[model samples]
Target: MPSHEGEDEAWLPPEIAVTVDLVILTLRASVFQVLLIERGEPPFQGSWALPGGFLRDAEEDIYDAALRELYEETGLEAGNLHMEQLAAYGTPGRDPRRRIVSVAYLTIAPELPEPVAGTDAASAFWTPVEQVLDHQVSLAFDHHDIVSDAVERARDKLERTPLATAFVGKSFTITDLQRVYEAVWGVSLDPRNFYRKVQGATGFIVPAGSERRTTAGRPARLYRAGTARTLHPPLTRPTPSAAPEEAR
Candidate 1:
């Protein structure tokens, strides 16, 4: 019989590593921002990157790994966050050391606390999305592409899902909700038109039997998230040409 050792080795597939990258988004000071960390290790050492790491053997699921890495790198809890797997990127040369298949996750939350950098990160901080997208700040690996995808996902969800509520408190004003849309869409919506559309979207919000007054304006009614999860008829965004000139 011919030697089978070489044949067996040739049939074995090469091992590839899996990592989880987080695009943790929040509305800060009316601007959309994402959490990023500076890598403490080589292969993009000192470069800013999404908070994430490789899947550990102890983690039974990819999501568990994502949560663990997020906390380990940024010290942010995964509690009550609107999180979902955004996409998978597995291009051969994405990682310099070896083959890496990264599963990117998108998370949205309201008023997160300041981040503390962990062992794998030199420093952690929130950076505005415009700076990242506009290349004012450089990101390690293919994180720029990942951020773009996450932003688009968020914008789409805002149209048909209750995702916008993730950026607000239990009881909030219509203006608060409108700010979320404006920040994510990067456009100014006409206040009167936005208020009307939101009220018209049945089951999108429920009056909470309360109102709060602002120093500069009349009392605004408080509302809570409604029972319906999806918008009946999606609240579509205006096209560039149709959007208000001031918004441009």
Candidate 2:
């Protein structure tokens, strides 16, 4: 009976097509930013959209496909990139082309070079997150939902995961780390309390043997995220801003 079931499974057609989409976020000019690409072809020509592509036969893993799409669209070579599966957007009408279900990934980077649009993209640029949320900008497909999901995931992760460090450079001041939290969470934190909380959270941070002076203050200490990726005794949270919560 098991053999028969396995044989039946082998003969079944792949009901859903697979694709990879990326929600790449970064900070530019102290503003939360997202990478968007302009569509060069029909279906949604001239509109902005997330960087993605169809999964080919050679790519056997979803994670690999996602990284490939990221590099292909943005010339961002995959390294120790902070990446995670965001969500699966599989609504039947989400795509006009067949039954394509995209496995979206949220990738955060400290710095991204200027994006060079590739075969499927007309042009690409980093757009501020505020613009996307306020509907001041339009996105192709259900990408707006994808982008929203990514932001919320990142915001929540900042509280319980060491994900906030991705926004800071190789070495960063404590204030710089605080800004990453503020930008994503959209809540201003009490500086003194935030400092103490992070320090008390075991393995959340470690000294980088570096220091730098700020414009209006004394020399500030520099640190990097510790090897322990998960935040123990998670960071404290302030009140959530009066923003409409998108339905997940």
Candidate 3:
């Protein structure tokens, strides 16, 4: 056997931290919004960022940690909301303290209640997506890039997935669902064409039994989310060149 070289030397593993951040998307009063938290600690103290934190322990599952952080900071449970991994952000120097890689998630929910800050968050609230994407509000760390990716992910998903249904209440009208697309896509949709496309998507929306909308318009039949999670033909959008900056 060959003589052993530096095998006796002690090896110290790099101290890399893992965290999860949530981009909770919802429609509040016809506007598309995302959940945000104000940090209370140093390294961008008092800055607004997505609600999230480091994994509680090595044994903790990433998804479970995300749910825990969501509840801890916002007091809102995931509970049937659509959540999926968005991406991983591992840019050196992104965090002032140490090397950190963050796993971002996009959570789609409908009309979530007001957030009450807790844990390490100084305050929590629903902020319109445009405010952040349009550079109105500054964020901590690399959260702006994270938010941009999450929003584009949402818009892309809206074209193929019925996740848009997750942005409305349990019961809503065709018009109600249309607004979700309009707000998220940042484009106006023709109501008639939207209704036709929705109707053609099998199992996309089932009529609510004996449920009638009681709003300003003429009596309209209510609908409950259906079994399908996608549109077969899928809704279409304008090309990036033809669309407004918001749409792109």
Candidate 4:
């Protein structure tokens, strides 16, 4: 047999660690907020980051790890949240401590109570998303980018999906739904136009056979989220016009 030693050599795989990061978003007091945890361990200890952690072992599922981390950091249990995979990030030097490949998860939760930190988190709390995107709050690792991506994802979902209903209670008025759009999209919508648009989106919402009294106006009809998870006549997001080119 001719020189088979080299061909028979065993192959070695790179040592890469897997982790899950959650971008839990919710609206509070008409402001968009994201959940962030202060790291309690080294490498980024004392720094704010998206709540997450390394995989427990080789056998644990990626999504299960995400759910576990969410619970650990927020005290919010499984089934109570509807998390969707946002994206995966594996850029070199993303994590300083090791070679980390993170799978990001996203969720739009209703108004939640203050979170109690667990696992390796020093403290967990909700902060305005604008603060992180605007650099008001410092983030560790590659979390700032993750937060930005999640925010855009949420904004997009509001246009294509009936995700805004997730931010409210069992029943809500048209104004309640409109406020969610205004807060997340960061724009004011004309009430008459908004009403017409939502009404056109068949199955987006349905009458709940109830009304809520307002301080200044007539009782607003309360509607419950419909069975449809998507909008037929989708809500469209506004796009800014391009700036005119300056004269040469």
Return the TM-score for each candidate structure. 0.92, 0.88, 0.90, 0.91
Candidate number of the best lDDT:
1
Worst 10 residues of 3 by lDDT: 239-248
Highest TM-score: which candidate? 1
TM match of model 2 to true structure: 0.88
Ranking of candidates on lDDT, top first: 1, 4, 3, 2
TM-score of 1: 0.92
Off by over 4 Å in 4: 1-8, 240-248
Pitting candidate 1 against candidate 2, the one with the higher lDDT is 1
Q: What's the CA error at residue 143 for candidate 1, in Å?
A: 0.5
Candidates in order: C-alpha RMSD to true structure: 3.2, 4.9, 3.6, 4.8
Question: Between candidates 1 and 3, which one is better according to lDDT?
Answer: 1
Off by over 4 Å in 1: 1-10, 245-248
lDDT of each: 0.88, 0.84, 0.86, 0.87
Q: Where is model 2 more than 4 Å wrong at Cα?
A: 1-15, 241-248
Over the stretch 9-94, how does candidate 3's per-residue lDDT look in tens digits?
A: 76567799999999988899999999898998877889999989999899999999999987776666778688889998999999
Ranking by TM-score: 1, 4, 3, 2
How far is 179's C-alpha from truth in model 2 (Å)? Answer: 0.8
Error of 1 at 180 (Å): 0.6
